[model samples]
Target chain A: MTKPVVLTGDRTTGPLHIGHYAGSLRNRLRFQDSHEQFLLLADMQALTDNAHDPDKVRHSLIEVTLDYLAVGIDPAKTTICLQSHLPALAELSMLYLNFVTVARLERNPTIKDEIRSRGFGRDIPAGFLCYPAAQAADITAFKATVVPVGEDQAPLIEQTNEIVRRINATAGRTLLPEAQAVIPPVGRLPGVDGKAKMSKSTGNAIALSASPDEIAAAVKAMFTDPQHLRVEDPGQVEGNVVFTYLDAFDEDRATLEHLKAQYRRGGLGDSKIKRRLEDILQALIAPIRERRAQLAKEPAYVLDVIRNGTAKARSRTEATKRDVVEGLGLFVL
Target chain B: MTKPVVLTGDRTTGPLHIGHYAGSLRNRLRFQDSHEQFLLLADMQALTDNAHDPDKVRHSLIEVTLDYLAVGIDPAKTTICLQSHLPALAELSMLYLNFVTVARLERNPTIKDEIRSRGFGRDIPAGFLCYPAAQAADITAFKATVVPVGEDQAPLIEQTNEIVRRINATAGRTLLPEAQAVIPPVGRLPGVDGKAKMSKSTGNAIALSASPDEIAAAVKAMFTDPQHLRVEDPGQVEGNVVFTYLDAFDEDRATLEHLKAQYRRGGLGDSKIKRRLEDILQALIAPIRERRAQLAKEPAYVLDVIRNGTAKARSRTEATKRDVVEGLGLFVL
Candidate 1:
């Protein structure tokens, strides 16, 4: 069977961080060779929450594109498009608003939880409330068969499929396809403070394009086993984030196994273990840093690629819009 | 000074009735000559309430256009357009949605009254709630300076101006113009049963394009003063619907006053007055009926006129969209 079309991206509120890389960006690069991929700089979606800060979104679009190129997300294999450039997505969203009830939107699990978490229970922006419908438009607009998202975002895909089913039924045309979710495997990387998740806003994330010094500083400060107070005390590896990073990125299996056994058997200090882990991290991240630095030299070319990619995305979307207009019976002439 | 622009429209929910004719179609015909007028067929607005049956709105677009032409709303002077043909309006509506709060939309006097009147209190279509914002887009899309509406529609204009002010202030550009309301002298022609309003849904409307037999039957059954139980008894003339129709359509002031006095002082039976009123209504509606019948024979040509008119309206709207996009700094390329 042909590889399924996959769509995923970040809202361009800021640069991609280590949390983003581990959660999605790295997976997107891997998916490119096997699936038809679309990496969107979702400026419009960013506006849902960042309405007062257009400058942030505007600047982030460039930063996000550069980060993607630096991280080996090939533009040739994965179309990187700007979300607002596709006007059809907004139009489709407006049409879908008719099929969806206001109550139904308020009941959307992910969006509702986000609102509650954001403490905007009574004062949610209507646009924020309606962004899920906008996401539905994005999925159906691309006609993607597979959507890669974390478990928390599975509800977004479910909402998109509901819209697809309703729109197809109403138009009496099967123009939009439902998308399947591809859940992330590693779940989430813990922050240096041993927090459950890493985030840019939480001051717990290292950026994808961070320099060697920044990464070293971040990793050096990471929390280890709390009870390993003495050099001779046995260390814990089960909940140790250093072991998690080693499990995810360390390539020297025999060396890492010896270090783990030495730590578990006692007598290994935290500094020695830190140095070993640091070497492993720097080796794994050196190439990503080099590639990103090279891409950053030509900001103009990166933007040009995004522009060209969006133009191609728009041409495909325009054809879909014609079908949508016909299906809605809004043919003017 | 160049002629100011006028924007007026009918919601394509049903056939045009005499209430529509006397209220708006009459003003549109006169205003077309004085201003650069755009008559919008607000099918999208109709869909807010009539969403379950979109075909009704789709089919009525042509009929509404025919009614405009039949009543002397000349396309040579006026541009008639379908609301959905211009996607820019929807885009404009989204931007305006941000400047407006949900509380403001809920507090809009016109929308609140309409919600209660339509029995859509809490179960309101969010689209229905936001359509005032949509109307703001429609009005400002053309940068229309004069909007002909009834007294009840005044708040919709206020809502539009609120957005216009916010847009201009936010963009630091005075691109959108404030539209003023143009209320007619007569609020409504009243139902034939002497009811306060003639609504299509109320089954009390006499269609402007009603056939000769339909018109004759409608006039014969029209409500007069109920106090005049006997033809010889004295009757009230002030609230009598026959006199109201005469006041609305009769150009001959002398004949109207004479008939009103004769019907008031007794001796003139209801049959005599009904007969005279029928002749007067026929005399008034004959040319419109003939035009409608003749246009009905060539539905294709009428459709072409609507197509051409919508194209012109769309072009005018696009010019405004370009200005707005530039004003908002949203023109990326």
Candidate 2:
């Protein structure tokens, strides 16, 4: 039996961090074994909001690729392709735009939230506003039945399905498949400061390639219960960054539960817990850092991986584009 | 010295009419000699508004191409290609969308007028709202310096120039040329009803391949001076559809002026002027109809013309896309 096709990717804005690992990459690693996976390096989508800083997107492509390699996303199992290199996606996007209304795009819950968060009022970039259609193109072009996204992003999957239904209805046949959003079991990983979600731009996250000392420093500075002034004082675990990291990274559930119980009761020091969390993190990231450093030296090999994967993706997508064009009775050359 | 490149096209929504001939095709015939011209069969643009009727757009491609050949537009001089086949245009359009804002696109007078006229309201197709960007892609992908547009469409050219400037500024060089709008000297041709502009959908248009009997019937049904009760009664020349067609088509200006004077002063009946108009139209349309009939027999040859021209266009536009991608520091595969 053929495995289900899965589409997932990162926006090439910066090197991904542990937040990406716990939230998505870890899930992607499992998908590679269980599914036919395509990992798109979404440089074009990155430009939707970062058009003025294309160099950042350009340079981050390698960094993000290295991060993927370091985290054990084997290229043999997962096809890693670049978004801008595939012309079919753009062509499909233009065609799909005619099927969706401007108001519908604006009313999309995902886009609306993003627009509000980014403070882009009426001056929103046209590409940013129309990205849902582009995303539909990407998902449908691959015929990927499964898409991994955050819970908040399920709306995007719905939008894609809406476009899928429209295209199929227009063609009088099922020309494309609707994608199901696979929400990861774990939620967002907070920054070391425990302020918000960890992101590369916020300067508070631990990259997968962080060195030994950097990992130690990030752990030392993690926020814990402020009212726990003394080692003997009872500490709250709900908002504590160190406890959160431990919850995400710790393999020994019984020992972590004991530690949490002790901390909640009394006499559990922040240093001791931070030391324990640091040990687990150091173990987690050390091999990844080494692997990333080794891969970083072979730039040509990494680019070749992208080039080969993109070529494969190009053929696959072009076939689908032709199918759609023919199904729509568009005059084909 | 290199000749300036001109970009021009007709929306493949219907066969070309006399309005299209008088308004643009005659000017295009002259442009083929003095400038390097690329004539786009704008099937993709037609989809923006006619997405519900892609079959019409598809069938009209041949009809419009036949019109071009029938009216003496030499494919050797003007590259005649299909818009949907050139992937570079779509890619460039997606790229340019990032350089402009949604509000800015909405504020474009050409788009605003079209939205109001179509009564699209907030339900405008995203593609229709963003066609100016697509048009920019069409013009700049060829690096065409001259774009033939109606006076009302000058704002679209302005929008294209804005995007050109933004792209050049982003690239830190002039990667794309700003296009100049070349408005045709003759204005819109009113319909035979003299109610509004001639249009195919309205069923008032005399197609370039109109039959002789059809031409005579259209001329006979044309609106004229309603108050001219007798041949001796004075007629109004200002709003007479026959006089308008005469001014547009009649080569003998002195004879036309004498006829107009006689009709206004008295003694020249509607039949006399109608007969003159019918004679001119039949002469003008007969050879075009015969050529159209001849060309329609060789569907393979017509398809080849589009195929060969589209292949040439694809290479040229791909080169430009590469330049823009490289100049913008986008990751190149």
Predicted model with the maximum DockQ = 2
Off by over 4 Å in 2: none
What is the TM-score of each predicted model, taking all chains together?
A: 0.90, 0.98
> In candidate 1, which residue pairs clash?
none
A1-333 per-residue lDDT for model 2 (tens digits): 999999999999999999999989999999998999999999999999999999999999999999999999998999999999999999999999999999999999999999999999999999999999999999999999999998889999999999999999989999999999988887888899997768767779999999999999999888999999999999999989999988988989999999999999989999999999999999999999999999999999999989999999999999999999999999998
Candidate 2 chain B: minimum summed lDDT over ten consecutive residues — where?
A: B195-204
The residue-by-residue lDDT of candidate 1 on B212-297, one tens digit each, is 78888988888888888898898888888887887887778898788778777887788887787788777767898899889989
Q: Compared with the true structure, what per-residue lDDT tens digits does model 2 show for residues B225-311?
A: 999989999999987888988988999999999989999899999999999999999999999999999999999999999998999
Worst ten in a row by lDDT for model 1 chain B: B324-333
Model 1: per-residue lDDT, tens digit, A1-333? 867788898898888776677778878988999998988788878877776666777788888888888888888899999887787777777666666666777778888888988787656766777777788888878888899888888998888888788777767879788999999876778776778777777877777766779778877888889899998999998788777766656668888788889889888887787777677667656777788788889878887889888998898777777776677665445
The runs of at least 3 residues in candidate 1 whose Cα sits more than 4 Å from the true structure, single-residue gaps closed, are A188-198, A224-228, A231-286, A328-332, B194-197, B234-240, B252-269
Give the TM-score of chain A in candidate 1.
0.92
